[model samples]
Target chain A: MKKDMRSGFFALIGKAAGIVAVGAGLGLGVNALRADGLSLGATRPTVGDDKSTAGSCSAGPTTNVPEASIDEARALYGKPGVTFVDARSRADFERGHVKGAVLLPYEAAAAAAGQASLPVPTDHRLIVYCEYVNCQLSSLLAQLLSQSGCERVRVLKGGYPAWASAGLPTGTGP
Target chain B: MGERRAANGDGAVSESAATSGVSSSCAVTRFLEGPIVQIAARLALAAIFFYAAIPKIGDPAAFARDIANYRLVPEEMVSPAAVMLPWIELVTALCLALGVLTRGAALVCAVLLAAFTAATTAAVLRGLNIECGCFGQSGSGNAVGWGTVVRDAAFLVPAVLVVLFDRGRYGLAKAIKRP
Candidate 1:
């Protein structure tokens, strides 16, 4: 009886493994057939890396939305056609943000991408930023903006925290 | 039987009546432990998995972004995980709903729920204010919180019940075996 029970347990495990294998095969196969299929072996580019091809304006895809260095962003600050867009949460935006930056939280912008007019003008050179260096919200928001016909969208390297730490102008509330 | 007991004594007749009462209660217990409960649990798990998986399957890229936001997995693995996880969920859900490979499917569901709960808890602890991504990329507003962790943890109950108590009753497995 004990031996039978043990074998039955193993059989159940085998069945579970089989299910996983089958699912993975289907996933990869279907993904390969799709037009928008992801390259499983390729690494996604880190947004702010200076050496990353993602920073090049001519990079092939929306995923390669260009990034602006802190110095570049500072220079463009308060320029006539430049707009700073905060891509963090509303709470985070309220806590502290780039001086004169408009709140366009990534989640809200993503949901309203094609349907609604973006908070920032599409004709403006939009500089997006989130919380910190590792935060992907800025890049993600830039992609959305780029797709939404905002031609000059760029992620701000090191995000708002970096700007603040560097003693650049900052603001709080709404 | 009541008449037979009555012939012995009044006290014996009462005991016989009590025995019948106990037997009726046992029937109720059996009903509660039977296929109805198992089927209900299985269907609930299947529905949740289906709802969660379909959106992710449709847009793996957005799902990949959501996973990257978690900051848990390495960057390269994010795409592959995003590509495969929804399909696994979908297959597991199908198995659960159809009652084919019910035990294995339930076990997988339990494990997935446990993993989600752990990931959400970790995010909450680290104060990473990100989307839960429990459902999919459309879950933009569904921020990760301790409440999200509790909800995922709560889902484990049905998954586990399906694992331990499901006997393929009223399922495709049982129907296939009928001669």
Candidate 2:
């Protein structure tokens, strides 16, 4: 008989050994990862956030607007006492911003909770804005504001670029 | 007569050498190509991860409560970690299925499963009876027990398979062939 016939027995043994070795190796690896994840137990929460956990999603007095249309924000633009906050990076705010708009980046609000500069008062009607459609920081900021228990929090109808593109009042901020 | 004898010897030697070479190479090739056994293993793992997370994602706070119950995290971060954990699981799972970054993805998954298994083992030995909250609290909480460890170990099998035979049934590389 050809040696190939005997090869089958060796292949079977090889596969069985492969399976066991693989399982044991991964088992050890899982032990290590679990140890690490446990070590990281509290650290996971300190990382990325601002939504879902911000405020109670339902029955939590949230002024959450999943999405805002540009036209809707524009209509709200001139409303008295409505604060249009540009919830974008500082660079975008400096390059140009919506007229009467203020810069309050999302990270800043969360990072500096007690600072006076953040417009995070319980009484203020806050509107966080970002670039435009599909951008998330504005929504995220709005969510944070809601979680922090602001009286009213909303993202701008359209983000900053949308307002600028519409030829609305824009350019520099105090 | 001498020439005929010499030719016969050469022919036999070549035949034996070729047979052994083919036998060795086929086993290696099967491993490289990701035989059906490995494919089944990967698919099994993908299904487990993708579905295990649906309930948790739907109602994250419940999962947060579970995390909090672990008494492991600080008061502040509990909620945020609750929201992000499911997303990480979902993304890693999709990556495993796509076979993109197979090694890294498998390693991460192995890590995750191992973590779960450790928790399961810990719960079992420590006599701390609590809901694993792995799939979420569907309504009533189930007690943590040996079943959870077994379930997690069952899941661990495929992660090991992937790590050992990473080329996969449908991967981007093959073994070096000899002439």
Candidate 3:
């Protein structure tokens, strides 16, 4: 009886090992087939970069804007076509923000982007910024704006904190 | 083969003893090993793996990036893993769902679940606040957390159960050749 139990356990292990081997073999075959036909190496645009939009989609060329320092952003404070978009949450936008920055919270992109009375046109420049350097919201918004036909979309360097530290114009609520 | 012999051996022992307590324990084991319960466990695990694999298979690049986010696989190997893992999942899911080689399929599921649990646990401990990426990247990603580890651990139960009680009455494995 003892011998039978030991052999049974071994047989079970063997069966499992066989299944795993077959599964792995099939997986490799499928992967090879996919790689042969498709271009899988194209990397998506990551945050914190200065490059023109690759125009991988239907929308025509939209320049990927560079990260702007506090000084550079201040220069655009009163520029005619530049718009500062707050990419933080609504609560954070309410607590403080760039004086004329409009709230376009990253998660609420769809509703805000779909608004009929959005301040800027598709061709206008959008300056997006979030909490700080580590935050991804600003970069994500920049990518989304560029994809949505915006002519230029730049992320604010150091985000809102750097701007606030420079004593640039600040506002609270809405 | 070995499983049948052990059952026969147990039968002989139980008959010789004829004790109420031993017989009751055997009865409970038999109930738990019933075909209906085993098949249900197999199908449940199959459904989860299928759902996870289908979306991932459609976009290998996105899945590759998600794998990179975990920082577990080497950068060069990420692409291959991204391409292959989903296909393996799909195959194992099909096997479990169809009850073909159910023991082997269950073992695969158990191994995958164990790996996921380990990865998710490590990510949480390291404070890597990234998407769990169990499924394909969605609009809002699930953050790596203790909850994710718990969920993966819970999934292992069905897989382990199927592996143990796989001699269930209903299955392609039985149809092909009765053990």
Candidate 4:
């Protein structure tokens, strides 16, 4: 009886291993065939640098977008040619945002890419931000804006929360 | 005549009473180990995994971003995990729902649930205000919190039960094995 139980346990483990192997194989195979598949070795774009891993497998033209520190953004604040673009949801924007920041939520901007005019002036330097550093919406929006022919685009390093925490100027409204 | 003699024999009544008690308990155990309970557990887990897999499969890039937000995986490995995890969930779901390799799929589901629980718990402790990314990138409302940790932990019960007690009854595995 003990032998039978031991064998049963081994058989179950073997089956589980087989399932994982098959699943991984199918996943890699399918991803390879898809157009939008990501390259496995690619690194996320780092702050303050234009060096970014080719994001997708297709290896399209890469964009050179940098991230700006809070101080740098503070320096640029209220400048004639600089604009702060909030990439968070409309609700988040309404709750609070960087003073003078224009609300352009990431999802809406992505959907309207190539068709709609972005809220910022074409010639203005743009600084994009979402909730925090880990949030990707700001980076994604910055990329979209750069791809849409915005000359100078930068993601805010720590995002709106970081700016607000640093005692920077802020506002709350639609 | 012989049976009556046995019933009336010394200790026979006590033996019968003991036998009745054992059988009643056995019946409850048998019902729990039966096909009905096993099938329900298997199907419920299957539905959840299937629902979670679909959106991630459709948008792996966004899914990768979500995974990166967790900050658990190294940046380079994030893409591969994001690409493969949805497929694994999908395959396991299909197997569980179809009653094919039911035990194996249940084991995978249990492991996945454990990992998710751990990730969410870590996020909560660290106070990272981010989406759970349990379903997909658009899981905007599924924030990582103690509630998310509890939900993933709760899912493990059915998954582990299916792994241990599933006997392949009413499953494709049995049919496929038949010559």
Candidate 5:
């Protein structure tokens, strides 16, 4: 029994090491390949050429899906299939918010998203907005949501400030 | 008497094997006995990847530009990575969450997180102020780095854990029944 145990331990250790090495190697190879030069890709994604396009922010493919234009989102304001995540403090959310937006404070966004019970369907669009761009909360919140599996998540550029500044309707806090 | 001695040796070998296997088998059994936490961990890891990759997948050029900002990878691999990595993440995350090919999916995640760690480390060491591009950054170009490392490390823990002990909890691939 002890002998068998010794062999099993060695085998497990060997397999674990091999797995780590292979995993790390793949990482470095990808990194090294990108380090070689990065001008062309298999297919360049289409984007708004104007870097200054309002109501639009770049969504990295791996992180989150691209959001709709403000105009498009306007139609989705309270619509189904669009999960509006309010990335603000609980107190602030209680002050005012958009209709149908869930109260997922930036600090709590990760924990909120970690749950499998949250009804936000995997196929729905996820939009995260915070008080303002200078706030630094929304960027983190958006990323957290994406990291947590919100497939089509978008950070409202300049966040809630832009929306309020644009005179969009604000909902009463819960 | 010679046959008896040989039998005694065989018994010793079997005893050693039993001792070793017992410990590991106990752990595996313990997990199989109560796998709720393991299931949660796998799902959590899957969620993070899905979230991380979706934004980058959407605007690959933005992702490419963010990758470029790091100055870790060469200019060439950037675009392909931008294009494929997200899809890989999306698929892997899906596989993990759905409980399909859990082990394979976890391995893919470990690979992604490990790459992220290296790239983030390289960028920081070189003093690049670039955004990690795990989430595509805006054209603002301010550079985002350190946080990337921390986030990747955070993800790495769970991914590695799953690779180590999690076989399949909630999704289609039950350890007793690998997808």
Candidate 6:
């Protein structure tokens, strides 16, 4: 029995090695034919593109939350302790932002531990926003907050521009 | 011992005679289990993985960045993972498609899908609104959420089916062997 098992193990490994060799050959052979060849560790994704024109944010087909309109955001902004988390850079935030909105950018969230630095009140509803409809940061931030156990996470519709255009209040610094 | 051997030989002869008169239903069953069905399954899985591998193989750096977006793998391992993953996909795809080591290839594909399902499930549970990157960079319209997880889960069925049904027939490996 022991000998049989040993032989079986060796046979399986041998077959697996053959399969790997074949796979490597096919992959590399095709890769070598490419115009660019194989480019490893070449570039990183760019941080932000402000030319967003989409109407809504989706985390994916699943875990999508209802979008909060500018009017809804304004209504919620006045209410005590409702968190409006800005998913923009600190530079962007310092230039101009919705009054009382906290800066918890998506790039920051990628590196930081879950909700560790943000002041997320347990009872508050978190409304996240970035640069208009095309900006994915807001959706990503909302998703992160939702993942971090925020029950009422929502993304602001049309993002910061809509709020500003609606003649709502704005702030800057720190 | 000779008497027993003669009796066994007679039993085999009778069994072969019985099987020679196979029913239409039995023939249909055999056809279903034969090369056609196996080949179709192999081609479908191969096409999918091949489509996935092409975009990633050329640009491992971009793929590495996509992997980084998931934050699943460690930073140091990301580069190596990115370089090898597409090649693995391509290899298994070729093996399965060409029927070269078909079962082994199917097993590899099954394992890859299982890993993808786990990763996507983790992302879903984590409330991540991210692209799946299963097929390189996700299109702008497609979000990597629960739908992606379900899709990956669905792809697993064929891989599992191939692994179970492969009998070393209708493949390049078998074709090359002279009868």
TM-scores for all candidates: the values are 0.66, 0.41, 0.59, 0.72, 0.44, 0.52
CAPRI rating of model 5 = incorrect
| Better-scoring candidate (DockQ), 2 or 5 | 5
Residue A123 of model 6: what lDDT? 56
Can you rank all candidates by DockQ, best first?
Answer: 4, 1, 3, 6, 5, 2
Give residue B98's error in model 3 in angstroms: 1.3
As a whole number from 0 to 100, the lDDT of residue B43 in candidate 5 is 84
Clashes of each: 0, 3, 0, 0, 61, 2
lDDT of 3 by residue, A67-154 (tens): 8878888898889988899987777788899999888776566345434334445455678998654356687677767655565778
Worst 10 residues of 1 chain B by lDDT: B3-12
B1-179 per-residue lDDT for model 1 (tens digits): 55433333544456666677778878875764588888888999999999999999998976887788789888789889999899999999999889999989988899889999999999999877677888995435577898999999999999988777776776898899999
For each candidate, report its DockQ versus the true two-chain complex.
0.32, 0.02, 0.19, 0.44, 0.06, 0.17
Model 4: iRMSD?
A: 2.0
Model 1 over residues A66-126: C-alpha lDDT tens digits?
8899999989998899999998878878889898998987767755644566668667899
- Count of clashing pairs, candidate 4: 0
* lDDT preference between candidates 2 and 6, better one: 6
Give the per-residue lDDT digits (tens) of candidate 6, residues B1-179: 23222223545535444454456557865765677778888899999999999888766655665666577887566665776778888888888778887877777788789988998898778765555778885333245677888988899887877776677778888889947
Q: Tens-digit lDDT track for model 5 on A1-174?
A: 999979855664554444444434444455456533334532222232212211122322344335445566676776768777787666767777766778776545434433333434546777777653433455556565455444577766556656766687778858
> Reference contacts recovered by each candidate, as fractions?
0.49, 0.02, 0.27, 0.61, 0.10, 0.26
What residue runs in model 3 are displaced by over 4 Å at the alpha carbon?
A1-10, A35-174, B1-18
Q: State each candidate's chain A TM-score.
A: 0.65, 0.58, 0.61, 0.69, 0.54, 0.62
Best by lDDT: 4
DockQ-derived CAPRI band for the predicted complex in model 4: acceptable
Candidate 1 Cα errors over 4 Å, as ranges: A46-82, A85-126, A130-174, B1-33
TM-score attained by model 2: 0.41
Arranged by TM-score with the best first, the candidates are: 4, 1, 3, 6, 5, 2
lDDT of 4 by residue, B14-42 (tens): 55655676788789767766888888888
TM-score of 1: 0.66
Per-model C-alpha RMSD: 9.8, 17.6, 10.1, 7.8, 17.3, 12.7
Q: List the residue pairs that clash in candidate 3.
A: none
Q: What's the ranking of the predictions by lDDT, best on top?
A: 4, 1, 3, 6, 5, 2
